[model samples]
Target: MKLVGKTAIVTGASKGIGYAIADHLMTHGADVVITARNEAELATAAKQLTEAHTADKTKAIPVAADVSLAADITRLFERAVEELGPIAILVNNAGNSTLDLVENLPETDFDAVVGTHLKGTYLGTKAAINHMKATGTPGVVVNLGSVETFGTTRGNAHYSAAKAGIDKFTEVTALEAGRHGIRINAVAPGAVETPMGQDATTPEFTAAWHRTFSVERMGRPADIAKAVVFLASDYAEWITGITLLVDGGTHLRGLPDYADFLLPTTN
Candidate 1:
C-alpha cells in the first residue's frame, strides 16, 4: 500500500479521476508528474497537491502537453524523469468525447477520441517502458478504459471502439512487458460523476444508469482512483492484463432502457 520512493506520471490529471489518482499517489509517498492539455488547470492542480500534502514527503511536477502528439508524449516522459526521477507508475487517463450517429460521425471526431485514448495510451506506455527496462525497475501501467468496451454506447461508436481496443492492447502489451517485470492493466469505469459525467447525466441518462447500477447512485471519481491505486501497487504484483470494471455492476445488467426517462412527465 506504500509507494514510498516511487515516481509516477498521471495524464489528464488536472481534474476528475486523474487528479484523484495523482493525489492518492502523493498520499502514499510517491512523487508525481501531473500532465494535461490545459496549462492553467495543470498548474493549479499541481500547486494544490503540493500545498495540501506539504508534510507527506511528496513533490508534484506539472507538465502541460497533448498526449496525442508524439512530440508531446516524448517531452512529457523526458520532463517527468528529469523532474521526478525514473517513473515506476503511469496512469494513462487522457481522453475526449463525442457522440453522433454513424451516418453523421465525422472522421475528425473519430481521430480526436481515438488518438487521445488509444494512441495516447500506447505512446505513453511505450515511452515509459524504455526507461523502466533500462533501470530494471518493475513498473505498472493503469489504463483508464470504459465499460463501453463491453456494452453498447449509443451515439459514441468511436469511444466504444477505442475502449475495446484498449482492452486487447492491455493484454497483448502486458504479455510482452511481463518478461521485463512490468504489469499493465485497465480500469473501465461506469458513469462517473466527473465534469464529463455531469454533462452526460441528462434525465434520460441518469435513469438508465440507475437501472444498470444497483448502487442507486452514479460512480465517483475516487472509486476509480482507488481501483487504479490497487492495480498500480504491489498488492497486485501477480496481476496483469486484466480490465477491472469499476462501473458498479453496470456490465452485469447491460444498458438499461432510457425511453421512459427521456419522456417528459406531466405533473
Candidate 2:
C-alpha cells in the first residue's frame, strides 16, 4: 500500500495498458479516476476495479472524456479532486494509431494520432502539474512512450514521431516541474500484447518479434503497469525526466520489421 492516501488520474484507462496501470495503482492502495472516450467501457472498467479492490477501500471513478481536448482535461482533474482528493499521480496513457507510410497517411490521421498521444499528454500533464502546485502536493506524472521512438518501424512514422516527442516532453517537463517538487517521466513499451498491439500486427509477426527479445516473450500490459507503479512510488524520489524502457530488453535488439506484416505485399 505504497499509495495508501494518494489519488491518481489515469487517462485512456478504459482498457489495455491504461486499464492495467489503474489496476496496479489501486492494488497499491490509491484512489483512481479513470478516463476514456468510451462511456460504456469506462464504466465497466470502473465497476471491475471497484469490485476487485473493495478490500483495500480503493475507489475507481470513471470519467468519459477525450484527453486531446483541454476542456475535457480540466474537467477530469476537477472531478478527481472533487471525488477523491488531491491528485498524487497522473498517467497519460491514452493513444491511438493508424499504420501507413508518411506519404500515404492523411493529414487528419496524423492530427488524430499526434493529438491523442502528444497533445493529450501535454494537456493532462499541464493540468496535473497546476493542480499539484496549487495544492502543494509533490505529484508524479507518467507519460506513455514507445520503443519505436528509438528505432525505425515503417508504417508508423506518425506514431514514432509522437512518441519521440513524448520522450523529450517528459524530460523537459520533469526539469520544469522538479523545482516545484513534481516528478515527470515516461514508460516506453515494446510490442505489448494489448488490443492495440494485437490489432497492429499478426500472430506471425508477433512470433518473429518475440524471438528478437532477450526475454524470449512478448510484453504484457502488467509488465508496463509495474514499471509505472515503481516510478510513481517514493522509491523513485530522485528519478525524473527519463524514459524508462520496459520492453524486456527488446530495445537492445531493435524493433521488428512491422512493414512486412502491416503493409500490402505487391508481387
Candidate 3:
C-alpha cells in the first residue's frame, strides 16, 4: 500500500489501458476517480473496481465526462476533491484516432484526435497542478503517450503529432511545476491488445508484431500499469519530465505497418 492515503483521477478509465492504470493504483491503496464519456461503461468499471478492492477500502468513483472539454475537466477535478479529498495523482489517458493519410484526413478529425490526447492532457494537468499547489500536496501527473511519437506507421500522422506534443508538454510542465513540488511525466506504450485495438489483432498482424518486438510478445495492460505505479509511487520521487517507453523494445526494431495489416490490398 504505497499510496494508502493518496487519491488519483484517471481519465478514460472505463476500459483498456486507462482501466488498467486505475486498477493498479487501487491495488496499491489509492482512491481513484475514473472518468469516461460513456456513463454506463464508467459505472460498470467503478462497480468492478470497488468490488475487487473492498478489502482494502479503496474507492473507485466513476464520473462521466469528455476529457477534451475544459468544463468537464473542471467538474471532474472538483468531484474528486469533494469525494476523496485532494488529488495526489492524475493520469491523462483519454485518446481517439481515425485512420487516414494526411492528404485525406479531415480538419475536424485532426482536431478531435489532437484535442483528446494533447489538449486533454493540458487541461487535466493544469487543474491537478493548481489543486496540488493550493493544497500543498506534492502530486504526480502521468500522461498516456504512445510509441507512435517516435516511430509511427502511415495513417497515424495526427496521433504522432499529438503524442509528440505530449512529450514536450510533459517536459515543460515538469519544469514549471517541479518548484511547486509537483512531478509530471509521460508513459508511451506500443501495440497493446484492447477493445480499441481489436482491429489490429488479426493473425497476420499478430505474427508480424511478435516478430518485430524484441520481447517476442505483445504488451499487456498490466505491464504498462505496473510502470505507472512505479512512477507514481515514492520510488520515483526524484523523477520528472521524462517519457518512459513501455513498448517491449518495439522502438528498437520498428512499428509494424498498420496499414498493411488493416488494408491488405492498399499496398
Candidate 4:
C-alpha cells in the first residue's frame, strides 16, 4: 500500500474519471474525501469506495462541492483534514467542457467550463500547498489535463485553453513548491470514454480518435487512474513538474476533427 496512512482530497469524484481515481486511491490505502456538485451522487460514490475497498468507512468522506467556487474548494480541503487527517495528496480532477465553436460558444458556457478547470485546479493546488507547508510534510498533487492542450480541439477552444493552462500551472507550481516538499504534476489523458469524453465518443468519433493511437481500444478511466496512483506514491519521489500522458501514444498523433460534433450545420 504505497499510500497507506495518507489522506487525500479528490475533486469531481461523483462519477467518471474522478470516481475511478478516488476508488483507486482508497484501495491503495489513502483516506480520501470525494467531492462533486451533486451531494447524493457524491455520497453514493463515497459509500461505494468505502464499502468496496476499506474496512474503515471513515477512509472515505463525501463532500458536495462546485470546484469552480472558491468557498466550496476551501471547505473541501479543510474538511479532508478535519475529518481524516492532514492532506497528503490532492487530485484536481474536476472539469467539464462545452461542444461549441469559438464563434458559437456562449460567454456563460465558456466561463463555466474555463472556471471549473483552470480556476478550480489553481484553487486546489493552493489549498494542497498550504496544508503541506503548514505541516512540513511531503505532498503530492495530480491535476487532470488533456492531450487537447498540445493537440487541437477545433470548436472547443475554452476546454483546450483551460487544460493547457493546467499544464502550465502544474509546471510552475511544481517549481515553486518543490522546495517545500510538495510534488505537483499533471496527467494528460487522450480521448478517454468518460462523461467528459462523451461528446466525442460516437462511432465516427471513435474511429477518428482511434487513428491517433496504436492502441485499438478506447481509453478507460482505470487506465488513467493507475498512472495517478503511481505518481502520487513514493515510487515517483524523483518525478515532478511534468505531465505523465496516459494517452496510449495518442499525443504523438494529430487530433481528430471536432467540428462535426461541436458545430451546428447551417443552410
Candidate 5:
C-alpha cells in the first residue's frame, strides 16, 4: 500500500495499458479516478474496479472525457479532485496513432494525434501540478512516452515527434516543479499488447516484434503497468525528469519496419 491514501487520476483508463496501470495503482492502495472517451466502457471499468474491492473501495470514479478537448480535460480533473479529494498522482496515459507515410498521412489525423498525445499531456501535466500546488500535496505526474521517440518508424513521424516532445517536457517540468516537491517523469513503453497494438499487428509487425524485441513475445500491459506504479511510488521519490523505457530490450535493437504498413499486400 505504498499509495495507501493518495488520490490519482488516470486518463484513457477504459482499457489497455491505462486499465492495467489503474488496476495496479488500486492494488497498491490509492483512490483512482479513471477517464476515457467511451462512456459505457468507462463506467464498466469503474464498476469492476469498485467491485473488485479496490483501495478504499468506491474510490473509483469514471468520467468519460476526451483528453484532446479542454472542456473535457477540465471536467476530468475538477471532478476527480472533488470526488477523491486531493490529486496526488496523475498518469497521463491517453494516446492516439497514425500509421501512414508522412506524405499520405491525413492532416486531420496528424492534428488529432498531436492534440491527444502532445497537447493532452501538456494540459494534464499542467493541471496535475497546479492541483498539487493548490492542495500543497506535492504529488507525482507520469506521462506515457514511446520507444518510438528514440527510434524510427517510416509512417509514425507525428507519434514519434510528439513523444519526443514529451520526453523533453518531462525533464523541463521536473526541473521547474521539483522545488515544489512535485516529481515528473515519462515512461516510454516499447510495443505493448493493447487495443492499438493489436490493431497494428500484422505478419510483418508480429515478426518484427519477435525479431527486434529481446523478449520472445509482445509486451503485456501489466509489464508497463508495473514500471508505472514504481515510478509513482515513494521508492522513486528522488527520481524525476527521466524517460524510463520498458520494452524488454526491444529498444536495444531499433524500431520495426513500419513502412510495411504501406506496402501492397497479396490477397
Candidate 6:
C-alpha cells in the first residue's frame, strides 16, 4: 500500500496502458478515478477495479469524457475532485494517433492527435495543478509520452510531432512545478502491446518493431504502468523533469538505417 490514502486521476483509463496504470495504483492503495470517452468501457473498468480493491482500502470511479474537449476535461477534473477528494497524482494517459506521411495527412488528423496528446496533457495538468496548489498537496503528474519524440516514423509525422511537444512540455512543467513540491515527469513508451499497439500490427509495423527493438517482443502496458507507480511514489521523490523511455531498449538502438534493408535482395 505504497500509495495508501493517495487520490489519483488517470485519463484514458478505459483500457490499455491507462487502465493498467490505474490498476497498479489502486492495488497499492490509491483512490482512483478512471476517465475515458467510452462510458460503458469506463464503467466496466471502474467496477472491476472496485471489486479487485474491495478490502476497504482503495476506491475507483468511472468518468466518461473526451480529453480533447475542454468542457469534458473540466468536468472530469471537477467530478474527480468531488469523488476522490483533492488529487495527489494525475496520469495524463489519453491520446490518439495520426499515422501517415506529412503531405497525405488531413487537417483533422493533426488536430485530433495534437488535441488529444498535447492539449489534453496541458489541460489535465492545469486543472490538477490548480487544486494541488490550493490544497498544498505537492502532487505528481505523469504524462504519457511516446518514443517518437526521440526519433521519427516515416508514416507517422503528426503523431511524432505531438509526442515531441509532450516531451518539451513535461520538462517545462516539471521545472516550474518543482517549487510547489509537485513532481512532473513523462513516460515515453515504444511498441507497447495494447489496443493502440495492435492497431499498428501490420507487416510493416512488425518489421519496424523488430528492427528497432532489441527485446524479443513488443512491450506490455504493464511495463509502463510499473514505471508510473515508481514515479508517483515517494521512491522517486527526487526525480522530476525527465522522460523515462519504457521502450525495451528501442531508443538505445537508435534509428536504424532501413533504406538499404528496404531494397530487394536477389536470393
What pairs collide in candidate 5? Answer: none
List the lowest-lDDT window of 10 residues for candidate 2. 258-267
Clashing residue pairs in all predictions, respectively, total 0, 0, 0, 0, 0, 0
Clashes of 6: 0
* Pairs of residues at least 3 apart in sequence or in different chains that clash in candidate 4: none
Task: Report the alpha-carbon TM-score of model 1 versus the true structure.
Answer: 0.95
Candidate 2 C-alpha lDDT tens digits along 1-267: 399999999988999999999999999999999999999999999999999998989989999999999999988888888999899999999999998888788999999999999999999999998999999999999999999987897888999999999999999999999999999999999888898777777777888788779987889999999999999999999999999998887888888777777786611
- Please list the residue runs of candidate 3 whose C-alpha ends up more than 4 Å from where it truly belongs after superposition: 265-267
Quote the positional error of residue 116 for candidate 5 in Å. Answer: 0.3
lDDT, model 5, position 240: 94
Model 1, 12-127: lDDT tens per residue? 99999899999899888899999999999899999999998899979789999998999999999889888878889999998888767667789999999999999999999998
Ranking of candidates on lDDT, top first: 2, 3, 1, 5, 4, 6
How far out, in Å, is residue 3 in model 2?
Answer: 0.4
Error of 6 at 42 (Å): 0.7
Each prediction's TM-score against the native? Answer: 0.95, 0.98, 0.97, 0.95, 0.95, 0.92
lDDT values of the candidates?
0.88, 0.92, 0.91, 0.87, 0.88, 0.85
Model 1 ranges off by over 4 Å: 256-267
Residue range 1-267, candidate 5, lDDT tens digits: 378888899999989999999989988888799999989999999889888864355357899899988888888888987888999999999998867777778999899899999999999999888889988997999999999887887878888889999999999999999999999998999878899778867877777777888876888999988999999999998899999999888878987777764444311
RMSD of each: 3.0, 1.1, 1.2, 1.7, 2.0, 3.3
Error of 5 at 222 (Å): 0.5
lDDT of 3 by residue, 15-109 (tens): 99999999999999999999999999999999999999998889899999998899999999999999999999999999888877777789999
Clashes (candidate 2): 0
Q: State which candidate has the highest TM-score.
A: 2
* Candidate 6: stretches off by over 4 Å: 255-267
Model 5 weakest lDDT span, ten residues long: 258-267
